[model samples]
Target: MGDSRPVYQRIADDLRQQIDEGVLAVGSRIPSRSELKRTYAASDQTVDRAVRVLKAAGYAEGQFGRGVFVTDRSPVGSLLRTGEAVDSPFAARLLAGSSAAPPLLWEATSTATGAPPRIAERLGIGAGDRVMCTRYEYLADRRPLQLATSWEPLALTEGTEVVFPERGPYARRGVRERFAAIGLPVVKATELVGSRSATSTESQALGCSPGQCVTVIERTHHTADGQVVETSDIVLRADRWRLEYHIAFPG
Candidate 1:
């Protein structure tokens, strides 16, 4: 019984298994190209391909001029989907379980831009409608933790005090309260989560190699009458955080 797989597949499988078993612990460098070739009795091309496979699948990442290393996928923290964090999501992201946590900080930029088609649909508006689009970056202990881009229809906030998400008195007040200021209280929200490869921009800001795995959450807030007030796309390094959703029993 032999593993008739190609050299690259075999190499990748072996290293992946090691990572799964913690033999190749996080932050530790994997065998170099020369070493892998020697051990597998394979050519340089085969070894290189194997390494590429590892990097592509998010099991490892390479530092500039440094060899490939196992990625740190340990649970750095948890993303709590409740309370004020939901109100001011633009401010902080990781609300991990009780423990002395790193100080959280964030930055955001908002602009009057045309809504992309997807966002337009989420807001129940026509494509190219003007919307106040905002981008956010969250950091903990000075390290990038997450990224988000939010879109709010200008038609809903044009003459209000909360037009800009990061400006004015109502800034960072979360959707419910901010909209409530204008007599448009948000009653509920919906979220959809999925996985994808990190884009070049995401990888750089999150401090991970390009093509690494990342999680994306599409969220929308609505009024009691089902009016869409805000929508956003949230992105974070998949290996670095655990997302928690608490459900209450209808007792």
Candidate 2:
């Protein structure tokens, strides 16, 4: 007896095998719907459904008015857990197999708003307290790979040049440097990691299906005296990235 899988699933599985085995190269055009139909003796609906599955699985993407093409299928930079700070951006230099200049790019915007209950609690502030919120998207070779939002209590940065994260000289500077400039030195940090299904908006922003999962990293930065200076929520496509760690052996 032949395989019992549905026609669409069988087609998707075979295409995935070709992608995995290098028969389909990254960024290369996949066979057109008509071609696949002819090759598999399937209907238009079957081929269309198979292509959707490939897109959802990050194996391929359809270009409007053009055709579907294989995606990079490579993992973005790994997140390194280390002792120096809470979380360091694992970027360009750490990208595997990427020899291009500036392997990653950043698009970010900052807004001043009242903190929500959850964010306020994370930053040790009361709900509705004033805070500076900055949202960012990290792109690898112009493709969005990660999203993050950082929140800081306005009380700590008020009257300082660092109040507006993207407007001052301290803009885009690391947390420690920004804090040091404001007389609040970041001495310790903590992080928690989890995963959940992507929301509709998140999936749209990430070009993934809503059913896909995302990895979330919650990071908090603290001053030496235990003041919460900053807290951030980082989200990444679960299938496109991996977490890494570097630590020294105990003395």
Listed in order, each prediction's TM-score against the native is 0.91, 0.78
Model 1: colliding residue pairs: 87-174
Tens digits of per-residue lDDT for model 1 on 94-177?
444623256777899999989888889999999999999999998776788889999999999998899988789987777888
lDDT of 2 by residue, 14-79 (tens): 999999999999989999989999999999999999988888777887788989999875765576
The residue ranges of model 2 lying beyond 4 angstroms of the native Cα positions read: 1-6, 35-43, 85-92, 96-100, 103-107, 139-145, 195-214, 224-226, 237-240
Clashing pairs in 2: none
CA displacement after TM-score superposition, residue 157 of candidate 2 (Å): 1.6
What's the TM for model 1? 0.91
Residue 40 of model 2: what lDDT?
A: 90
How badly does each model clash, as a count of residue pairs?
1, 0
Displacement of the residue 140 alpha carbon in candidate 1, Å: 0.8
